[model samples]
Target: MKSGVHRKLLNYFLGEDKTMKKFTLSLAFLLLCLSYLPLWAGDYRAAYEKNDFKTAFALAKPLADKGDPEAQHMLSGLYKVGWGVIKDYQLARKWMTKAASQGHKEAQSSLG
Candidate 1:
């Protein structure tokens, strides 16, 4: 048996466990949280649907800056159509290409 702790933990993500198990659980939770943190905000698309471009922009811009391709795609649309912003094809193209480089599908289609 591997007898060393290849596990880790944090205080905020505590769950039921013994000391070592608690550590491992907390670490796992932390990793999970970190992994999904870039997209943590739900209802972003929902906000867009409600024509709340300001809300959508607010929700998507930071993630877009963080290299989230989907957010980039959304930002491209916001720029293209002037949703909560001034319309600028150049800016739209810029954001679309940024997203396309990150494998965003809609960005590629828009580029076509």
Candidate 2:
């Protein structure tokens, strides 16, 4: 089968030995995820600014679980403030450390 320019471009960029369909799917998924990040963070920020801890927690938890530093920092703050979840210094410290390890400045300051 002839690979299209999209496949060629994906191969060039990714440098991986993936099938055409696999490469296309992976690229699409990556693009979708990247596009959603700003909206997802905006939603989280709106929830946080409104003091809707439950909503903020709901929005941040998945991204945090996925190792997003900002989400981890938000999760840490939520734990620290007993918002949407019980205040747990240990959990806060744990998440803060994770974010700090990812070079999040606020997390670094919090850890310090």
Candidate 3:
């Protein structure tokens, strides 16, 4: 009877150990994703305000490529108005269309 109880206790401890390992692994993965997600720029706003549209354009392009509607809209505006970039209406229309197709209201307004 004592040996049977010891076996049950051992199984319970083993189960808890497995559960703890799983929990730790899941937490680590979550941390990794949160730290790395949407890795873009350090200070896009500062770059824009400093008239460093070149850097703003650089930082926003990757986010725009990833389908971020706000980034797409800004990139479209940059292309449309020649804001630190050569005016290119075709590129502007392309990005505006992309944002509008995603249901971005501002992008639709800009396209019109």
Candidate 4:
């Protein structure tokens, strides 16, 4: 009778161990995929397209500050249109010029 109880406990523990391992592996895989997400400047374009201006501005500002020309161009428009931020044409032109200097075609044409 004692041996049967021991066997049951052993099986229970083994089953729990397997479940724990699967959970850990799934969590790890999810984190790995999240870590591999691209940091492209245009990544925030979806937010802008959705008219989620606050989210777009929040995402673009950091990339623009980090010297991303595409982000600079987008940020320029955000400033010009007062989307999720105060209107400031001077700031818009400043950011546009920065993007244009980096060979952003749209910014260059807009500047002209």
Candidate 5:
């Protein structure tokens, strides 16, 4: 009886330890992925600067939808110029307004 109880306790503790290790690894991986977000944003800007509007739109659309002001501003420009999407002043104004509301200076100036 004593040996059985001890074995059960050991197994329980080992299971918990494995769970903790998994959690720690998962957290680390998540942080690593998040750390690359800025690099992706930089890629978007570089694509735009290089006149790779399609790539820039592909990159910025997601971030803009997630409410990144800079991405929203870039998306607005893309919309306004029909660079990567159909020219739609309505959509351009919509994204520009979103960026301006988030205190993007260029967006604000453009709105003015």
Candidate 6:
């Protein structure tokens, strides 16, 4: 009888531990998906169209850094015109070159 009781208790605890592990894994997966939501949802063009250069810069910078040609072009324009950031022709040229190299037609034309 004592052995049976001990075995039941051990099984209950083991089940609880398994449940906790599943819950922990689910929570981690949720957080991971949420963290990437901004990158997936950022609308830099809408921000720029609204004359919100600061927001546009914030949205575009990460994508530009990740080698997105359109984002690089937008960042280059912002740097060239001193819109959201200080006007830095050097940085503008750097980003424009990156975009042009990626075959961004507007950036290529502007560079030419």
Worst 10 residues of 6 by lDDT: 11-20
Give candidate 3's error at residue 1 in angstroms. Answer: 24
* Per-candidate alpha-carbon RMSD to the true structure: 6.7, 8.1, 5.6, 7.3, 4.2, 5.6
Best by TM-score: 5
Candidate 3's residue-wise lDDT over 1-112, tens digit each?
9998787668666785566677778999999988875453445556877988888888888878988887788789889988878999999999999999999999988767
lDDT (C-alpha, whole model) for all candidates: 0.81, 0.88, 0.82, 0.89, 0.91, 0.92
- Cα lDDT of model 5 overall? 0.91
Q: What is the TM-score of each candidate against the true structure?
A: 0.64, 0.67, 0.62, 0.66, 0.73, 0.66
Q: Report the C-alpha displacement of residue 26, candidate 2, in angstroms.
A: 16
For 1-112, candidate 2 gives per-residue lDDT tens digits of: 3678777777667856457667778999999999987886668878999999999999999889999999999999999989999999999999999999999999998778
Q: Which residue pairs in candidate 5 have backbone atoms (N, alpha carbon, C) closer than 3 angstroms, thus clashing?
A: none
Per residue, candidate 6 scores C-alpha lDDT tens digits across 22-70 of 7778999999999998766468988999999999999999999999999
Query: On TM-score, who's better, 1 or 5?
Result: 5
Q: How much is 9 displaced in model 4, in angstroms?
A: 36
Give me the overall lDDT of model 2.
0.88
Candidate 5 lDDT for residue 8: 62
User: Compared to the true structure, candidate 5 yields what TM-score?
Assistant: 0.73
Our model 3 lands, by Cα RMSD against the true structure, at: 5.6
Q: Give the TM-score of candidate 1.
A: 0.64
lDDT of 5 at 96: 99
| 11-93 per-residue lDDT for model 1 (tens digits) | 23354336767677799999999999645665567789999999998988888888888888988999888998889889888
Ranking by TM-score: 5, 2, 4, 6, 1, 3
Clashing pairs in 2: none
For candidate 2, what's the RMSD?
8.1
